[model samples]
Target: MTGPLAGIRIVELAGIGPAPFACMMLADHGAEVIRIERPGAKKGGPGGDPTKDILQRSRKTIAVDLKSAAGIGVVHNLVASADGFVEGFRPGVTERLGLGPETLLKVTPRLVYGRMTGWGQEGPYAQAAGHDINYIALAGALHAFGRAGDKPTPPINMVGDFGGGAMMLAFGMVSALLHARTTGQGQVIDCAMTDGTALLMSMIWSFQGQGLWRDERGVNLLDSGAHFYDTYVCADGTYVSIGAIEPQFYAVLREKSGLSAEPAFDRQMDPRGWPELKEKLSAVFATRTRDEWCAILEHTDACFAPVLSMAEAPAHPHNVARGTFVELGGVVQPMPAPRYSVTPTVAPRMANEQSDTEALLDGLGYAPDEIAALKAAGAVA
Candidate 1:
């Protein structure tokens, strides 16, 4: 608890994907997060190792069965002292459970209630079950991925889930918390993945509106349309990415890759010649290993780097020097980001090593006997 958000407290209704990731970011930056899990919920990381689940780190966990009135009462007690709350259930689910914004805001008037979903709170697809791909597809982002002749490639879950949903929710919660501290008011944040994904494409949309971009997938400059801004396979079957967009950087690319003497490469901005230039560049790149190309163009203004896999990324010299990744509980994972000069963030630890039900109930003003009775009644675990 050393970062800028050290004094803040958040209550997270335990969920998968975006909501958990948002809670993790808040907890990482020193917000004290209490994760409320259901009784008998699975307790392990993605690989069945509890410590390896990076999304669940840096939080205290308590099990409360929301079906019981006593369980709902426990949440209300926690909300009375919490600055914010988060949940990712479908629309109206929390309302049915008596844990909606209207119910919780009555307990703490300044609470920031964050809701995460795919299609959002109100829409034709709001109640339908969907995932990251479906949301980004509707946002016009999925159609912009992949090569010209190839089908749309799902960029895993990064674009919609972590990037759009979790990151946006975290930003909204912090913003709403700031406003609450100033005016003593609370509000709901309807953080839909579809809305967030669309917001993330603002720059691309601008390009299209200005007639600088085409609607096709791989024909845009930032996409894989430009020969100088794509990945290439080398002699060793390893890959390297090039992003020599500026004239100066592209000149360095042409020089270092021995393409300066070729007149065909001079037409860098000609879209009609991109296909031919890309073929020639691919052949040139295949003549050398990825490491060889890195040695030639990596340090130059060519904007080049080897396309390291997850296994190689942590071991890269630049990443190691910056402490970008850390090993905790025998698991290698990324560290909390966006450093603060004054209030440096503390290192994160494994979550839910043991239950905190008794301690939490005690702090909530519940007597030991009452806690025992609630547990006996199958209300808490």
Candidate 2:
């Protein structure tokens, strides 16, 4: 607990995907996050061990049965001591559970209440059941991610869940917390995945507005249309990405890849010649193995990088040199990101449900008998 957010305390309403991810970011940077897991929570259950769930890392967990009045009271008490609260339930779920902002605000006026949802708190689709794909699709992000003549591709939950939903909630909470510190006032943040995803498309939207981009998929400069800005399969069937958009970098790609003399590639920015030039570049790239190309272009300004698989990424020379990944509890996962100069982050620890429950309740001033009584009442697990 020694990073920029060292003194912050957050109460997380345990859920899946984005909610946990958001808290993980907060906790990684040294917020004291207490996760409230539902009693008998079966998430990552069966063969799914909680220790191996990377998203649940770097936090303490307590299991509370929200269905019980005592459980509701338990969360309220925590809220009073906390600086921020995070929940990803549908719009009205917390309200129904008696832990809504209106109820909690009375106890702690400076609490930043963060609500994560797919649609928004007040929109027509706020109550609708949807996942990451559906959320990004509605945000105009999904329609722009595929090759020409191909169906829209889902970027696996990254674009909506982690990028849009989780990151937005984390930022909202931190910003609101700062505001509360300054003004002595807390606020509710309705962080919608759809809105966040749309915000992520701001640069692309601007390109469209300026007539520098097309609405069609795969036809834009940053998409797969530019031969200089796409991936190519090598003779070994492995792939490498190129983003030599600038003329100087593109020259390096041409010289390093032996495509300098090719006439079709002469007009680098001509849209009409892109398709034919792409075919020629593809043929050239396929002539060499990925490793062979990496040797010549990997260190150059060609903006070149081999498309390493998950197993290979951690072993890459640059990543190894930077300590971008770490092994914890015999599990290999990414280290906390956005490095700090002072008050660096501690390595993440494994999550254990109810492991800190007794101590946490004791800190909340629950007598030993009162804690036993709550456990006996089945309000805590």
Which candidate's lDDT is highest? 1
Error of 1 at 155 (Å): 0.4
Which residue pairs in candidate 2 collide?
A: none
Report the Cα lDDT for candidate 2: 0.91
TM per candidate: 0.98, 0.98
- The regions of model 1 sitting more than 4 angstroms off are 45-49
lDDT score, residue 205, model 2?
A: 95
Which tens-of-lDDT digit does each residue in 1-381 have in candidate 1?
Answer: 499899999999988899999999999899999999888878654565556788999888889999999999999999999999999999999999999999999999999999999999999999999999999999999999999989999999998998899999999999999999999999999999999999999999999899999999888798899999999999999999999999999999999989999999999999999989999999999999988888888778999999999999999999999999999888789999989899887698986556688899999899999999999998999
lDDT of 2 at 213: 96
Error of 1 at 93 (Å): 0.7
